[model samples]
Target: MIDYLFRPQLLAVVFVVVLGLLYHRRQPKPSLPDLPWLNTKEGEWFTTLRARFRSTVNYKQSIHQAYDLYSKKNQSCIIGKLNGDEIVLPVSSINWIINQPESVLSADEPHKDVLQTDYTFVHPVVVDKPLHHETIRSELTRQLGALTMDIMDELGSAFDDIWGTNTTEWREICPFETLKLIIARTSNRVFVGLPLCRNKALLEHGIGFATAVPIASSLLKLFPDFLRPLAAVLIARPNRYHTKCFSRLVRPEIERRQKLLEGQNGDLEKKLGDPEPNDFLQWSIRRAQESPYPAERDPDIIAERLLAVNFAAIHTSTFSITNVIFDLVASNPSKKYLEQIREEASSIIAADNGVWTKSGLAKMYKTDSTLRESSRLGSFLGAGLMRQVVAPDGVTAPNGTFCPYGSCVAVPTSGVHNDPEHYPDAATYNPFRFSVERESSTAESPETENDKSNANITEEYIRKANLSFVSTSPTYHPFGHGRHACPGRFFAANELKLLLAYIVLNYEFEPLTERPESKWIGTSLVPPLTATVKVRRRKQNM
Candidate 1:
């Protein structure tokens, strides 16, 4: 009875309506773009209320409906959201939108609003000063090559510890839970290094913090402007606890690094026996030392930044790999896809003398395609490239659609991903779609005489460039698009590929009867949380 009553879909609607009613009288009208609303009688209070209520439950449905009606015609449209309204631009406007200056269309602003960063993150400096992003975009990315072996080591240990070593019998394990554990430990190997990365309390609280932010944000959005501060305190209590837990775990490490930096005299090699740590904590401390604001160098703030990065890395990587695993198991009942992926990975690893290098991972085209296809089919968010209009006068699309200041604008990421025009048979999970195109593009023979012509060479080059999992564009943006796209995507792609490659080569999965259906709460697709996989270890380890 509790399960039936608290199902995500039902609970979302009930929660939205009840809270919305309480704040309805005091809430101000949302400033919107000059576009068609997915709802009817847009100005009528009761009608708008009903539409907003429907949207929480039918957000994906409305996305598709708007796509067919407006996006197909190359026009933008507005859709109701539980928090507010958003203007979803068509594929035609993506380039123009992303090219706009940050002052006009702010990328980070929307995230700050959605995550309720001021409250949930516990320090204004964490969001106000985004050096963490710089750490990821520069230091973390630069060190990925060096960190690969460490991640590989952690991945193996995590798998053995959580999945166990019984090779003879098939074991059933929950994919989501196990993958979350594997991702947290594996990612933290780069974030904080060993011992601390393996701490059970630290990991649990980190996961709790990741889970709490969204819940706290949702609850905070339910209150009127005047009551939000009080509401946020009550709603974000869990996040506060989690933050304290992270601070307790990481404070000692931060202090040790501070001392090392302070006494180094700009020459760390002079330390007789202490080797410089090659991890994110050390990198962040170095980065923060250069900041003009003193708070940016505070130990607690640094710990919060680590928590923020952990939240980003663990949550998204877990979702991505879990979807890939499920898609591989159930998308095709036949063994063909798995066999091909295994062959590609094994051949590449063998060619590299059994070392997993960045260049080596690049050559596993089939493995890359399988993950990309799953991303398209099972996207985590309905929209991408969401931004807030920050200029006082607002901004206008190239097509002359006007989005006023305070309006949230986004592109329908999943809509484009699912469009039949962009992807052939868009609904079916065809894992080899990109690889087949790749093989043909470089093949001696052509599918047709036209394919051999010089006219199509540019098209083939573009297609080849976009085939990698980290690449993003207007039509395919699971990692987002343009200059402001997710900075950690490159590291994430490498980690995911190594994990997938290892799984295919070392274990065998019992073919699932059907792909487990995912649940959609609001615009996010929650992968089958409790879905189980039957697996047996191969006699030889890859």
Candidate 2:
């Protein structure tokens, strides 16, 4: 019998049986590691895996459904195994991770590989050793305030020109095209300043830079880390294009300024600051001398940073603006919303001696509410406040469940924003929600008037609102959270508000389709591509 078992056929059969046993043993044995109170069945393991696969097809859709399940079950946390090694911790568990300090549960690990790709130009700057995060943050904060104030006239004028009453019929326009022009002009005005803003070749390069960098960065990300630097060099065309544009269009002006500074006495140069060193280039140059990465302070580097800002500003702003337009066109109720915003803008413009200031912008609370409402429903990100678990730690939710490291966690922003708990009858679009909250808060605490006012309408308010979703605190974050939250968001919010205000006040918009829903791919949510809207220029009563 022993001799027969050693035979080829017999050996083969025994080998197969042994392998099957080993494979079965290796298969993950799912357990309710977090649910100390409730016993979960073995079938739940398979259910979790199946759901994970389905959810992987489109994370946003799955997240929305997961929140609905969470709401119905009245559960703060749920646990599911994704494939063999991965796990799905409910939104609450993810929140716990976000709440923890950088020392305890670092975002550095999880997001390291996620953002290292070529598609993200700022990734290198962010991950580089010598570049201080605080320094960059401070500089950016100062730069944004100055930049926003400086470009108001140009931005306002661009709005007037693009949507001006000169055209009789509203031609079929590409929202992307219209938005690109606005973004390029606004960005150029701040980046290189005037004359270059009017440079046709430079503008074309700026527009193309937005599309190319993201594409290349995305491609670069898909490769291994060791290969990224090499890959960036390989995909150098966009960088080259940017360099060429900067060299040709911006370099001469910078050199002239440099010459002027060299010739002038210290006092005169300090007083004049190169006659007009008023844009991002000048700002970056001034700060770059103090930076460890002095090479990044170069005109090319300034161009790249400007390009990065544009990357952050353009698509997000356009998508948001387009969504608002879509929403206004689709909903019958939106006519009043549009009218309300127009009246607010008219009043503010009239009150401000025909000027739009930071204070004047604040008075358009209704418009702010409308945009906030639109973000609540039409937010494009699949998961808000996403973070990759870096440290070898676990997040224990309100239910005492722990989500381990290596897990990608996010706040169910769509869930929270649409949650009846937060916003009553959350599906309905209500512009008055924020405004009402502001009034109630003001009445309750008069001393907190400044707090309440700033809470509702400031750029910081919007940034905080978007970050709140991803934050452990759980307010409403459509953008993200923590130290790494979007820096260009202030500019994006103001740009969208101004553009929408301009349109609502001057044009009557009618959508060709009924309310259109957004389409989700993985974590990306894109609004309906081809919703036709008719625009009729409003007659000036004056």
Candidate 3:
């Protein structure tokens, strides 16, 4: 009887949902961007729900149609309903929308629904504070020069650990989880410092937390906002588990550092007779100590923030690496893509006495372009850089599309990136696409094919054409653009470049029969988890 009628909990949820539906009209359906609706109608309170369900069914088709319709109609943006709320998804004005003042188009507001961040294990300080981003953009980025060697060392160890003793034959591996493990360890080496990053328990807990977020967020969305607090208690157990693990593994170390601070009367490295830890934990601790808020200084709070950093760093970087690898095998059938990247990396590494430095990573134009192409095609979000309008009057775009207060707005990052207007032959995966293009729009002396035969232009030409992985432009926004662009991008770009260079030089992937397409739902773009590539260690490694 219970099975036929569904569990009591499920039945109760249905009853409450029906009640909420009866009252949902109290919520207003404000003006939209005037784009045509799909399977939609007037006076339908459930348009948002139906739209979301339809989107999930064939998201690529739906998004492509939306992009095309808006483009054909010459609209600035398209209005779409999602999860019972309206959103302004900008098409022509992506750059303008992303750069809008957060006071008007607030970035922090969207996560309340998307990630359920307020109710999850994510610390408010991590989300609200500017310090964490400052740490990434300034302090952590400054240390990357000194930290490169450590990252390379961890990278080698991670490869060995995951790939194992098999060296001779082609061994098929799951690019999905394998790449995550590689990126997780390498990133943690920088975030947590040695030993702990490799600790089975610590890595497990860290990866577990990140892997649990989307699941938790999705569950939280099943309930209406007023009931989410209760639902969060029941459904957010993974977050609780992650919080306990982070506190357990990391809080002790934070306390020890605090004791050291007290023992030395606040001279952390000076009195310890050693250099500072040169890791995120120590960096965060120092910054936390300087915070005006007492909550920011708490050890548990510090652990939560560190986990948040891990969450951001690992998810995007892992997909990026995985996508590029899949593209290397699946997209490049001629295998020239592999040879070019391998040659570039090999030549650079050989010049540096086999040490992959920050400078060395910079010169691999082909490898950098491969990652950029992957990012454009398979970035973490289909439409992101979301902002909520908080202004009493909301705001209007440069194109004069008004986003009302209490409504959400976003840019079609994927649409813009994939558009032929921004990139010629945007549908094709050309590994060296950015390598041949001008590095930036502002660059005065962009090299051209005509420069190829001019010996006088040699180094200058190479320099002009080479695109830095961190460079952001209005058209290319995997990391975003303007003031609020990703701060950790510098670290992320370098990490992935080095990691990819190593893979390119040391292994050859057996191409897949078809291109592995990424899955899209809501705004999230998930990589093909079932994708596999056959690879073998090169003679040098063997």
TM-score of each: 0.91, 0.74, 0.88
Residues 1-542, candidate 3, lDDT per residue (tens digit)? 11222345655654565566546546565555554554456787887567666765665665566566664354544434445344535455666776677777777777656778877765655676656787897789888778888988898899878865466888888888988888889999998897788877777777887877777677667666777776665556677787788778988889988778875558877877888788998888888888889888888888888888888888888888888887878764665888888888888888999777877776677888888888888877655667778887878776667778877766556777788977889988888887865434333332456855666555655455435567776566777677767889989988988888778767777767787788775656888887787888877741
Candidates 1 and 3, the one with greater lDDT: 1
Off by over 4 Å in 2: 1-53, 70-96, 108-112, 118-123, 126-150, 213-275, 333-335, 392-405, 439-473, 511-513
> Over the stretch 410-445, how does candidate 2's per-residue lDDT look in tens digits?
556677777788778888877655664442332221
Question: Which of 1 and 2 is ahead in lDDT?
Answer: 1
The 10 consecutive residues of candidate 1 with the worst lDDT sum are 1-10
Residue 167 local lDDT, model 2:
44
Give model 2's TM-score versus the native structure. 0.74
What's the candidate order when arranged by decreasing TM-score? 1, 3, 2
Which candidate leads the pack in lDDT? 1
Ranked by TM-score, the better of candidates 2 and 3 is 3
Backbone-clash count (model 2): 7
